[model samples]
Target: MPLPDLLVSAIALVRDRRVLMVTARGRDVHYMPGGKIDPGETAAQAAAREAFEEIALDLDPDDLVELFEVVTQAHGEPDGRLVRMRVFRAETDASPSASAEVGALHWVTTADLDRCPPAGAEVLRRLAASGTID
Candidate 1:
């Protein structure tokens, strides 16, 4: 039997034709600033909590707009494992800095997709195709 999918919630913060991405401590691949949805937490709530924890940016759960979802082979996982990521778009006026598990922050364009994990690359592709980011 196949392993169950890993579920995650992610937030997209686009600015000036670029979207925010982060590298977790000890990881080279970039991903959106979010993480696994905790028990008893809505996806939106998890996204917001992760934004604050990972990037030091507080986000209101009410302001998160469901952007897209991606299911792809899990990066750094055993073969046949998959990840299901729920992506959300949210606007914030405050600057984001690396925090918690984050090691570095980057504002990336679609051209940088190769530096991301499979699911994160897909998010960049869709965002660029929609003209939400360059």
Candidate 2:
């Protein structure tokens, strides 16, 4: 396997609750809101930009909350042929605004997340255990 570049992903939370879960058009898995960090862009900047482009929600780099970082593959990402994503976590009062590239946006509770996507569920559990969120 070519293997994907190392990536960092973030889970968006609001009022100590996770707010967004992203699913591509054909994907059954619901991942967090995040994307690749451009060579010149800082991880924080990339997080905000990706949120806007992927969901039409404008976010400030400062709004990015430091969630645990993880590495994942981009072989079948909805966008580019390949990429390395650096993810972050933040809270937003705004609802998810979809862009052309995105298929659906769902607001989920920490409890609900577990049933929707196993991978996301596991991450949330870890983050919760780490005191990142309640």
Tens digit per residue, CA lDDT, model 2, 10-96: 546544444577777777667766665768877888778788888877878887766555433354454333444444666667767
> Could you give me the TM-score of model 1 versus the true structure?
0.96
lDDT (C-alpha) at residue 10 in model 2: 51
**Candidate 2 TM-score over all chains jointly:** 0.68
Clashing pairs in 1: none
Q: All candidates' lDDT scores?
A: 0.93, 0.62
lDDT of candidate 2? 0.62
Ten-residue region with minimum lDDT total, candidate 2: 72-81
- Tens-digit lDDT track for model 1 on 1-134? 89889889999999999999999899889998989989899999999999999999899999999998999999988898999999999898999999968899999998898899999999999999999999
